[model samples]
Target: MMAQWHPIAPGEPLRAGDQGPRIAQLRKLLQMFGDYNGHPGPVTANNNNPERFDAGLQLAVESYQRRHGMAVTGVADKATLKELERPPVDLARQLEVNAKRWDKLPDKPGKRYILVNVPDFRLHLIEQHRVVLSMKTVVGKSSKRTPDMTSKVVSVVFNPTWTVPRSILLTDLLPKARNNPEAMHRRGYRVVKYGTNTTTPISDKSIQSAARGKATLRQISGPGNTLGRVKFIVPNKQAIFLHDTQAQSLFEHHHRAFSHGCIRLQQPEELAYALLGPQGWDRTRVAQATTGDESITIKVANPPKLFIAYFTAWVDGLGKVHFRPDIYHRDN
Candidate 1:
């Protein structure tokens, strides 16, 4: 079947009414994944336009795209084609690699635990082996990958201030903010002499001092705060955090590896309620904490265990095998 169906030539995508070997190629490719359910027969020369991309084929392509967390355009776009082109052997090898990682987990992790599959860009709240809550997550980019380690989520912090990470301070923001101090002002950051509560005015000298590692910045907790409204604290030496992000659009992306090294959640309010409920906080209390000037950190008496793992291949709820692009290249 590998040789029987190959990636459709990467050019103009195969769309409705298009016909030729490319259409036939897409037809076969979708069928291979059980995405195509119509016209199982072959496209023979004697037939009239049997290879045309029709409504059925378009629907199948949409189905396949949706399952893989891709834009559901109902066309053989480049991204879709690229995913289809993954060699079967490579997929098999990835599955084998993930199997070893999966083996590290206990047979019964717990009745309630958090599973953040980095490569999958998803978070699952599994209780009794069932997904009680699921949401899209943005992880660290490849260069600064979200760590693969297990810990316990001990608390939820709301209206959190951003103590800008050192890496981001030096690499992403320093140089620009040095010349245009307003950059820091616009983002609600206060320049403070490093290791002190003393706030410095937005001045080129202050920005330069910060850039030279003489000072630091902390973003005030408010509407446009970087950490959104809440963050889950995991007691790890790496200082890793699972937090809410103000960049809501990032969740819509199929490959959500944009953060420096934190896990950004799409539905922080929902998760906050779930995690803090046992500790006497409800939806209203959680929502209230997100506003106002005060920052709040509440400890979870029965904190859920956390498992942050990299899995490029896994089975979905419908017993269908799914594969994510090796975004972190751990498979490599």
Candidate 2:
């Protein structure tokens, strides 16, 4: 049976120095989640030895923080306490929900494919059912969620231009541009005729006309480009594709869900080199393509299948079950 424990009282956060029945409780709860496995039984060695928060427990707290996408400060802050307060999900229930989702995957997703686990904020490049590469990814925000779908990655574009989506242009960009008219030129953006090569200087009339579908706006290829150094094209109906980003500090956060709809990659070049294969694409070639302010495209000889999937919980190869928050609230 699970060990009986008292409730942790609300107060200041628990750090490494504090010790009491609450410390013992924290140890027990962390153990339940597989983040703490230091000793068998209670933390107290004996009545005289009472519970004491130490380095071992601190390490466990950090592990819990990492898994939950919280700041890895190794301290039991209010946020950490709040997460611990929630009743732990039964292991059987987690497995059941994950199993149902796993059943939907293809029996064989080709010899090469990319698996994006939305809730986990991770990307796994698989070859022959084995993970060859894994990287952190910034997914869509809760308001603009990344959809689940299967597509094929066909090409890699270096020094890519950013075409401000009509929706974003109207809702987000235009409003900001209105306040700062020079925002267009300063950000390497230009107003132009939709689907045409002819370019015109930015003006109030053009901006107003673009809002009415009479013109289009796109950012020039440069360092300021929001798409960063490269983009991986995955033809999908949602107009979503994987690409590099200028705002890379987001990766430092354990929980990375700060994009409009497209997924932002941490190490996109590694993926580009892998997908390009040996035919002619390599580190040196990729560097040359993205080195300057020129748009370049390299078509892969064989495109890898892309699978954007969702699963809140799963057991890893080591038999340890991992769980993630249902950011999209699709589990209910």
Candidate 3:
């Protein structure tokens, strides 16, 4: 039966007031998924008013998009239509995945711990198994997907310098630097030899070699740093950590999976305070620490447990089933 749910032909999204057979199919699908109750807006002779993409149907479509972690545009977008066409994976499969994750969860994930749900693009501060705070998060894209790992947040660095990753430098920055000799300096980057402690000015020829993975480039800690004003350090081999981004406007979008690999926090200051308040850190202290060009790192005696997890579908506390897109296509 699921085999027949093929994607509609590529075209502009079906917005409100649009009436067609595609809208009819969408209405049926929404009703099947419990998003459409078929009430409060309009009533036709046949009861199931499928042809019209009215306000009620638009609301249901938005709700479906929200549950599936898609862009909640209230229109039948290409991505949304594609998602509608894809066959739903069985509940048993989702339950199996959730069970494994539950088994791996620590007995006491610390008195205060941070939970980052990769697929949900959300971060929650859990204290005693109850969420005390929640915020939006921008995770990595499909190509450079954010990984699932458990670690402890040991420290927070303010005015942090961004060390250009070898992968990014080799692929993105090196080529740009080769063309413009002053590119690195203009972008607040300082070049250094990989092994030695010597930091020197970057020459045009040196930039070419660096492109070939020969040297290291580190950005200076300042207003325009990619790491923003602060970052949370979790000791991991993958070199992944939580940090702030200068682009705060991205958070306005519903589907925000735009990053290299590190998780981008929507409210970095609030998160810092949540983790550091126990250590006598406050807004005033954070401001002082972040005032200079130098990076300030503060150690946490009782670091919070950090769990980066991915769950495409799960049952909420109220027993409502919530489904999200397999953004990384991990659930084969």
**Residue-wise lDDT of candidate 3 within 1-332, one digit each (tens)?**
35534445556678988878878778877776778866564676644556878878888988888777777789888788777765655645866776677677778777788889998899999888789889999999988989999998999999998778998888787766667758668877777667755666678766755666667787889888888999999999999999989999989978788998899999988888888887898888877776778888888778988999998877777665677767888777
List the candidate numbers ranked by TM-score, top first. 2, 1, 3
Candidate 2's C-alpha lDDT? 0.83
TM-scores of all models? Answer: 0.85, 0.88, 0.81
For residues 241-261, what per-residue lDDT tens digits would candidate 2 score against the true structure?
999999999998877889998
Task: Report, for all candidates in order, the number of backbone clashes.
Answer: 0, 0, 0
The runs of at least 3 residues in candidate 2 whose Cα sits more than 4 Å from the true structure, single-residue gaps closed, are: 1-11, 39-50, 89-95
- 2 or 3, greater by lDDT: 2
Candidate 1 Cα misplacement greater than 4 A, ranges: 1-11, 39-50, 182-186, 192-215
lDDT of 2 at 33: 74
Better model by lDDT: candidate 1 vs candidate 3: 1
Q: In candidate 3, which residue pairs get closer than 3 Å at backbone N, Cα or C atoms, i.e. clash?
A: none
- Model 3 CA lDDT for position 22: 78
**Which residue pairs overlap in candidate 2's backbone?**
none
Error of 3 at 276 (Å): 1.3
- List lDDT for all candidates, in order: 0.84, 0.83, 0.81
